[model samples]
Target: MTTASPADELALLTRLRRDLHRIPELDFDLPETLRYVCGELEALCDDVTARYGKDACTVFSPCKSSLCMFFDRKSEHATAVRSDMDALPVTEKSGAEYASCHQGHMHACGHDGHMAMVLGLAHHLAESFDELPRSVLLVFQPAEETTGGARFICESGVFERYGVDRIFGFHLWPDLAMGEVASRPGPLLAATSESTFDFHGKATHIAKAADGADSLEAGMRFVLDAYGYMAEQAKAEPCLLKFGLLQSGQARNVISSHTHIEGSLRTYSDTMTVTAKQHLAELAESRAAEAGCTCTVHFSEGYPPVVNDEALFDLARAALPDLHELPEPLLIGEDFAFYQRHLPGVFLLLGTGTGIPLHADTFDFDERILAAGLETYKKLVRIP
Candidate 1:
């Protein structure tokens, strides 16, 4: 099959992207969105196979709607490209003609564009199957916004089954201009963990403050001490300890007996991540004990820092054109880190021109950049 020109591919991809944008779905519940993606993959198969007389199979996730298109299944070595298939909970304010039709859910992170670019690669691969060097897999992943799907995908042993050599994924960065790409070899994104603390103490009237074990006081001390430790740690390495939720007394006249504190921990260094969790847990316990209160600390098993494999990074730098090496690590967390833990891979940042940041109500990208993304995916697939 002869592939369409760049212009034709972009035009078709624009339409498909809008169709996906109109029906944004949340994590792990993308029934209609899944159907649309599978339909597109199937359509590509029918069109390209009929024209070229080649064979291919597009596999749909049995439980969810994630789609994987395989070309050259018999080859010993395989290459995979991934695009997430989930939307954030942000409401759309972009006011585009193709803005999300679903309320309170939007593809504000540009996953719709990511999916489109990968599909463009799939279409190109289908059309040019004869010249392809090795087997290729296009993974349409689900629940990326919540950091919930990649783990499941890794656990499914899809990579080992196909003997995938190295994989590539990218996120659109509105912070940079169109046509620019930035990435590095290590810690492109941070590891993220959530910590929750609960304090218990005796309740007493405000006038009888001395009689109460003041759980609120204990919680306050814990926060301040934790923050101080975080500050000190930051002096040595990058770290973030954010306490976004805190609940204490119900009335002004009561010495609170119970308090709940929730916060997020992020760091580029794995050693720092482990140390910080230990420090916070110890501080919470000690402070609560001193205040004559009991405390419970729960740290979530969160995403690890996205550490690009060195060998894979060298391959990407040489293979991708006009690549910019990022100077510093981003504190943002990505579950794509989970994929790297299993096999060599590199996560890339494709610039989308300056605009409203990701996860915002007005988040959007320049459509022209979609071609760059498509080209990048195609290049990665061709990596030998």
Candidate 2:
């Protein structure tokens, strides 16, 4: 087992990266993004289908390429390899030559590299399908940032339509050294959801503030107390309790009648995730009632936890470096979890060297891992 060679993988991955970096698309309904995806897969797939999530539809076909082609649809197996397609609502600061032309939108989360790796695999695999023991489905999904696309595609029945037997995916990680693979068999990702709490009370002049319950103050008190409570009670694992935005009080003289809070909660275990959510809801409800205000909580059900199949991972175990140092169930969330929702799949972290966390404007990763990724995907597709 030659694990994975570096030079050959890097050259092709770099080209794929350049191609994807040129065009960054936002959440669902990216026509251009879909076009590139279909165009790249045309020569490799025996059949191509594209439904724009609307009434629009199209047939994808192949174009001429000097690369030797290799797919035999006669093979009786199929699998889904997903790479997110949407960019975040961010501005590009990297003065790179191929900086995003779309204002205020950027691929801050290494999603561009992800697409490149998978598409590189698609082109390579399509040409070498005859050498593969089975078939693979390339899923260029949009809207992963908002956490809605996975379920939409799952509901759309792409997996069932293709008869996919197993699934696999990867994510970019700057926390690890370049080229390292991070994974845990049981749970490599956590279940997460967003929670918003709105508190409302009677508005009254500050001079007569007693006439109305101070909802703003109540909201403040609740947040302070809630954060402390969650910290103390969260499951003994990776967890988070932070509110990114909070606004209240319309005027200094008038008592604030409403306040809204937007934040997220994470827990490695399913039971803990549910329990933590319930605790937050109860605190909000009770606090609102005590202050003579009404409270409503809205929750966004994000991606579920990712649990890799031990058997499938065993086959590629040798390719991973420092496999023993992988973290315990992570509290991060991923839409790729949906692919595993249908079949045996693993979503591991591909090393991008050290850098700022993903989703930040300054976020960047080592492009060198693109080689490790392309070859890894190619090898996976080659084996029986």
TM-score versus the correct structure, for each prediction: 0.93, 0.83
Against the true structure, candidate 2 has what lDDT? 0.71
Q: Tens digits of per-residue lDDT for model 1 on 124-145?
A: 8877776777889888888887
> Which candidate number maximizes TM-score?
1
Q: Model 1 segments beyond 4 Å from truth?
A: 47-63
In angstroms, give how far residue 193 of model 2 lies from its true place.
1.8
After the best TM-score superposition of candidate 1, give how far the Cα of residue 74 lies from its true spot, in angstroms. Answer: 4.6
Candidate 2 local Cα displacement, residue 366, angstroms: 4.1
Q: What is the lDDT of residue 310 in candidate 1?
A: 92
List model 2 lDDT by residue over 157-232, tens digit each.
6566656677778899887788876777777877778879899999999999889977888788889988888778
